[model samples]
Target: MKHVYGTTALLVATVALTGCGDSDAGPMPGMNHSSSSTPTSAAAAYNDADVRFATQMIPHHQQAVQMASMAGYQATTPEVKKLATAIKAAQDPEIKLMSGWLTGWGKPVPTPSHGGHGGHEEMPGMMTEEEMSDLGKQQGSMFDRMWIQLMIKHHQGAVAMAKTEQANGKDPASIALAQKVQAAQTAEIATMQRLVGQLPVS
Candidate 1:
């Protein structure tokens, strides 16, 4: 009958349109959206904690690198020099890593305030300019002792910050990096403390 044919046609068209609508609606239900246009990963969900961790830690690591660089000429002890080299190697790459994260997250990387090169004071565990200047003036055994003491404090500060990141960060990458920081710095703190006891009182 004409009526039956018309109803069948209408049902077919309705089914076709429904199929098209579903196809256009994006990935199928339960599909991993990360593979498609929507990035539903932890890295994409950078929160305030992640941003703060990156911004604050960059300057902290920069100061560590600066202190480590000073050891090449200022440090007299082989152990101190070795530690400094390791610190530089570890922290310089981390700085770059955090910088990349900030850039990818569309957040501004925190630069040194007042155009101060190596703006260490803006963050905790950062050396004051005067303290750095004093350390710079030292050499031989004196440099070795002061460097160990200062570095211990610096590492402690980094550990504290990293712990905060672990507690508060949403981004998986940032939290992972913070865990690394906490472990590495805490170990370094133990090493520096041992070095402090071994060094002759200055």
Candidate 2:
């Protein structure tokens, strides 16, 4: 009976020691028990350039999304439709992503201007009210041709903006996104240039 008690006490002591050791170790580095409930600090670090990149890119992408949506009904060519779908797919998420960054960084998200160019007429690749109206008026093969031309120019502006962000933006996430934008838009620009030639002028 004494041996049994001694063995039981030893087992309990071992468990207690183990538990104490675990307690002393505390939470592992970078590990959070309530991580799901906690907001991540990954976006905590940012700068003026990062803020500007996110702010500017939001509206730029919004316009691109607008243009892409128009291709649904306006463009007659399958390739143009496909390209427009892809552009919308790519830019829409990016707009949300950049908007999130701006919000997290405590920066004000740029509201899209209604009717007019929203004072973004001077912004690279931004279409004026007249240009957007003109594009909207076109249909069938004419829209395909004009959209390809205009989108190519629009993509060029986005690429330029991405390059600037990559060069000047401080946040790693912003810079990485800018690099992705540059490569993707550059490829799309090439595709549009080729597509425009095949589209009928009328």
Best by TM-score: 2
RMSD of each: 5.4, 6.4
lDDT by residue (1-202, candidate 2, tens digit) is 9999999999999999999999877753233322212222135456787777777788888889999999988889999999999999998888777777667667788867532556576458888778899999997898888888888888898898888888887766777788999999999999998888887767
Give, for candidate 1, the lowest lDDT window spanning 10 residues.
32-41
**Highest lDDT among the candidates is held by which one?**
1
lDDT of 2 at 85: 98
lDDT per residue for candidate 1 within 1-202, as digits (tens), equals: 9999999999999999999998876554433344122323245467898888888898888888889999878898888999999999999888887877777677787654522545455567878888899999987788999999999989989998999999998876677778999999899899888887887765
Off by over 4 Å in 2: 1-41, 113-115
Query: lDDT score, residue 71, model 1?
Result: 89
TM-score of 1: 0.76
- For candidate 1, give the lDDT: 0.81
